[model samples]
Target chain A: MDLENQKRVKDLTEEYGPENVVVLLGAAEGEASGIAAETVTAGDPTYAGPLTGVSLGLVVYHVCEDEVKEEFDPDVYDEQVSMMEMVLDIDEIAEEMQAIREEYTKY
Target chain B: MKGAGYILVHTPDMITHYGTTQTSERIVNPESEYLKNIEANLRPYERVRAYYPNQTYIGNITPLELKEIEGPWQDLECPVDERYGKYGEIMPQDEFYLLIQAVDEFELVFLEKSFVEATKPKLEQDPIITPYVLGRIKEGVESERIDDMVASEDAEGLYMGDKLVGAVKKAHAFDPNLSAHVMVENLVSKASSALALMYAVKNAGIDRDEVEYTIECSEEACGDMNQRGGGNFAKGIAEIAELSRSTGSDVRGFCAAPAHAVLVAAGLVKAGIFKTVAVVAGGSTAKLGMNGKDHVKKGLPILEDVLGGFAVIISENDGVNPELNTDVVGWHSVGTGSAPQNVIASLTTDALDKVGLKVTDVDYYSPEMQNPDITKPAGAGDVPTANLKMIGALAVRRGDIDRKELNAFVEKHGLPGYAPTQGHIPSGVPFMGHARDGILSGEMNRVMIVGKGSLFLGRMTNLFDGVSFLMEPNSGPKEEAAGVSTDEIRRIIAQSLRDFASGLVEAGE
Candidate 1:
């Protein structure tokens, strides 16, 4: 995850309280998406830069995950993120996001 | 013996406008939300001077002094005209602008005639820039040329007090690597690093000509399209700093570069390869306003406004200054798992174990010392404090300290974060000047300097990188002939001969 994005996630979690925040990741790779999800839910697993040891424990989901896709307006999701979704392995990304959220997310 | 002297230079003016985050954002979207909020939060030179961390950075105040002050340092002011510090100085943006032009050998940087005329006198007053260096500044061109270049040639305009004062022209026609913005960023790194080198030479009380080798370890890469990361920042910085005798190269490991470079310098000195080696790095404009959006949103001052540069002179054992003990350097190996516990252990306990020392033995630990005022608002929390906690936890795991004593251990060995998050700037090297002072004054026996980097950012490998080494008071000068006098050698030889004769007699009997 980008260091600035990590900061934003942490700031937003603090501002709205962790229970109110939900991180939506858009990484094409499962590992990348999982890492971003884990950074917000747990701390940065990579132990790199600012997010190291900073566990916000916020709810997180990948854009390709069904839970997130279901929340979006069907036409809007199809119009915006549908093209990239075809190339990405949705199952792999969704599974990784689920795994991270289950292990680390507190709310 | 290693690490003869050290100095750190802070350039607060380059942060907001030139930092990579702001510049890259502006390039992608000129009307970005971050850019809109930047101007309002941009800190003036006066406020930056008054900021406690800035004062501590320049050595205007000590770390302890900064710790004693109240929270939200932006609200508190410690106004002073002094720009110099025991280690280095906090240079204003105006003089730094002149320096960028002065150090520009490629003619990429151009200043407005009136702006130069107005600022040259002030720059001339700087004690570090000798007349020979001052003469390097070219007479400025008209604002018409700057305006034309910015409009047609895609030059990045240089601003002072919101007034167009100069511009940096792109070096290549279409190569993104040599774009005007990149050139300005690289030049800023080079010039600020050179300023740091100048201070290092001055503070070390050595002639610039005595420096034989320089290693630039900044995050910036100086290269064209063919070899995108090809670099010679070391020689580039040396040239501007008037280190005529210095030959050098660049080392890149993201934030870990400084620790690597410093270790390499120490090795070179210890091996008698070089009498004096200087590890120098300039600040990144790209990182200047890295957390500006967060600071702005939080109604806090843009704390990431400083471009940080530092130079450490490593020479053959001086018998007085603190020596870098390279015998037991900590390294995060290729196979080291990327777990936080693993990273901290590799950099702290693993290294200490090699020297038969425990975590509690090190008087101080300097690791990513990013100022909390800047990072806390940015949601990074206190970076140094986080690192210290990890180290402390490791200590508890190793039975070096009890869990109940963790806070006390952290308070004793850790310093408050004060360095700007200029990538390599904050990594372990910031406390070197203080460590040197502490060792010399007998206040501290040893300090561990650790640098950690995220290699995944480069997309090459997921493996993390880190290195650490100890700086301790020199154990006096090495004696001639390994401390064995000729008379002692002769006496030993005689004693051995007598013993041999007695043994022969016994055997014969």
Candidate 2:
């Protein structure tokens, strides 16, 4: 690893704040994503193609039960699934979203 | 703009790991160590097997053509990491019983064994509810056979779970109750995902009201890829959960949604307009794609899982989880991102630039944690792990850190593989909750949470990829300038909010 690239990233960060900086994730899937990547990264000399990500699913969520139906009855199982309520509280961001939801519902 | 005020880390209720091994044949209790291991992983959270009404043929749509399946999928051709193909291209696909996980209540110290499993299970072997319901509906309509799908607003008698459950029941027009005992788990995959997410909130002690926004990330096939019917019908799952109150929008960003979600939460909090935002994602077991039985006959384990789900809460409020660096630098900058190749460069550098931290300053980088073993079964090679290595190498190249150091970072902090290849579920950002916990406990400082979405995978043209990193310090709560009670604070803010609304109303004129 060389300090030159580090400084380049450093200077770029200074010029563009963290919110505005665009570090390309070198995930090269084909089709539109490939074209977009080429247009964005290859089009710009500053674009960094090599990138990475973490598989957070294993960390945050886990399999509580697999192969559920072999022993369980689907009718009994679905009843339980329905009995349990699924709720998402949006009041937290109600201020900005009230209008959008109303519009979406109208659509 | 500034650091999050209070961050909370939740021990997941359960890590519902499902293995891919079932064949298309209607095998009864077949033996496969992979299948056994999957069952072993899901033993914690109360797993639900919901019977989705009008599933059509989710239970028996095994693509049996690609026959001649065999051993573990990883043992097949193109085992290398670079091979790219839609996972569903493989086969031996069988009926998928979507599994969902959640902790009954909030708790930390993630020893998943202590987590309670969701009791909701999907469709059982016998699925005869549709005929029964159609008979019931015949009492009112002239035709016993349904001419239009539930989407037809004019259809007199309709039954799909939603807010109209009460109205439908009173009218006796729809009956999900008749086929009872012969349960058929509906493709309520999103609900399964949400069930697991609620645990992240409660176990982490996140207040439902504290969450100002919820960013839901799932596959392009979510709600069946159709605009209207995809949302959990009749159930009004989104509203019942109260994901949005008077504020917030349902952000649909494909696989990159989880990352996009967290960034949205962070943005709202940083702007001081909101206090909390939770980025949530659900699972879809039916994406068994076109592979399934075809792969099974071809000797590949069934890539579809019976269950799995994950969620992370990001907030500016205190007492829930450790706050991520509120200073966001780059967001794949729309037209300036790559597919998966450039995910790291765009994500890592963007955040580092905000705090003036170089690539090496990133104590660690985490990416698509897709298990190669699972993905290979689906025809999508080792994509997740490949992203991780790329970032580690990038750290070394920048001279910001050494190759050994970066390698050590991944080796030590990297999560043990467990999640099923549930498309958007096992993405890079899922680890943020646990990593944030580790960071606060002095395990590390500044973890880079990079998330990216594949818009092209959904066949959407003019679409672009999105990636962003959430940076956090390895320390405890930071001191604030002053203190105020929540009620008083809410009142004060509400007054301003009321004024802001009034202004918007006036301006609209």
Candidate 3:
């Protein structure tokens, strides 16, 4: 969400190539109770355990529910199981954050 | 003829989502290992990386890369894990649905009306499926139609859990000639084979029509009452892939079919019967989850969920692509005992000896490359490793290599097995795609593909079957023969006839 975090994601994407990047959203399974999103690319320091217990992370590619309806396999991401907040486009969000940082620095 | 393309489709749903369907029920008998261990095994993953997009599987990685990787490959860390190679991406479940839909040549397979509606957009988004195949998909069939068909036991519905995803209709109305069960098996084989054909066309950049002949060498049988195994899977797949000019027949030899088929294709080319011949095979649904119980018992996911398919082309000397060395071919003679040493010797050493080469002549050897991840848990041991060791032991017996060098021999000549145990799939053919690349790239030369089969399972014979062939770098342009014209041949025949007539006249005088 922050500019620094956006840069971190962008750097990771660049390392694995944008096409190789897969955005994973974790399910609330064990101890925790919220859908948490994480980005997986080629290089990462380590895996930050999911908010819940062991979770088979789901791929969250689309940003909106309307977009998901058209392109997503409901079997892969279900309302009963998957969390919505986990859907973040690292590339798109990173670009937006970069623009905001540029404007702020100009001021 | 110019090139080869290989594709592997992973049907994870067959393991997790479609487990309740009759197909699964048929495959998973009550006393079967998979069914008994369902409660213990980890849920199958939604996707696996090995069956990734074309770029990941075909374009990104070459056979050289796969061969170069040192064995006991699983120990290699991620991104590099034997499970996660550099080349292929693990295709998602939705993509597979789109693929099966794309390759549905006839109206036999119907996507559930609701599921079709739900997946249309995703299908549209698919990058690999041809526009023609994708365009054939229409609005879903309604629930009433699917329900009536299911209720009447007229159709077998494809499922992703309780929800209906698709259904396959029977080919015949009254005759058991085309029952729903036979129709489904044939369709799956056809669809998968067609996909392999499509990939061959894509990878080779050749028109489907250029494939003059096809040879289908899978373990599945497709025929009616009169002739059970009397089949035409090759033509069925050719029809689906729209190779109107190609005609073909099926080759059956249990697991050894692919190798035998390759030899057949090479011979055809060598004899100038066909300028271009493609050897292809589709996957078997019957073998799905075959080792699931063992995997589940070991707290592992069902590794045998993927159906494997491959297609390789053998054409006249292209001077570019690898050549199928016709001089050296291995066969398991009737007298060749079933001992491991004998089989390996006949398949490797004996064949090489004819060419004045030793067992170590081949830089790489591919023999029944069944993935250890799946086979080890099932107590079959590491099949590929065992095969390499057997070959090494044979080499030692021949004094071709030192007994102490057996491990090094295996390490040098054998590769980590990555093929599924889909009977014929785990045979030698899985490595052909890579072997072709390796030869062309000068990464290596003289790779041998050995296929072995159990004929006893057929109940008609107690014999074992196997055949092997070597693939090597092109020797350069073949010397062309100054061919005689038809007119010249006609003149020669006339002169010979005249001489015979003159001789008869002289004898009468």
lDDT for B416 (candidate 3):
70
Docking class of 3: incorrect
Candidate 3 stretches greater than 4 Å from native: A1-107, B16-47, B50-106, B125-128, B173-177, B480-509
TM-score of chain A of each: 0.93, 0.23, 0.28
Over B1-509, each residue of candidate 1 has an lDDT whose tens digit, in order, gives: 22222333334445546776666666656776667767777777767766778767766566766667766677777754356665567777878888888888888999999888888999887778888778988889998999999889689988875677889999988999999989988998888888888877866656788899999999888899999989998998898888999999999999999999999998888888988999999878888778776677678877777778888888876555678888779999987766566788889889899889989899889999888887766645677877887788777766788878988887888888888888898899888877776676688898999999988888899888999999988776575235555675565345434533542353233
Ranking by DockQ: 1, 2, 3
| All DockQ scores | 0.04, 0.01, 0.01
Q: Evaluated with TM-score, which candidate comes out highest?
A: 1
lDDT of 3 by residue, B1-509 (tens): 35555555566656542333224434424355555455344333333442222212333444345556544333343242122122122344445565565655557777667677777776566444567677767677777777777668877766664566776777768657577656666666666777766766655545677788999999877666777677888987777677788999999999999999999999988898987788888777777777664466567767666666777777777555678898999999999866556677789888998979988888999999887766766646567777887788777767888878988998898877777777897798877776765676588889999999999888787888899999898786574212545574455345434533542353233
The C-alpha RMSD in Å for every predicted model, in order, reads: 13.9, 23.1, 21.6
Q: Highest DockQ among the candidates is held by which one? A: 1
Q: Order the candidates by lDDT, highest first — what do you get?
A: 1, 3, 2
Q: What is the DockQ score, from 0 to 1, of model 1?
A: 0.04
Residue pairs with clashing backbones, model 1 = B19-B285, B19-B286, B20-B285, B20-B286
Model 1: lDDT equals 0.78
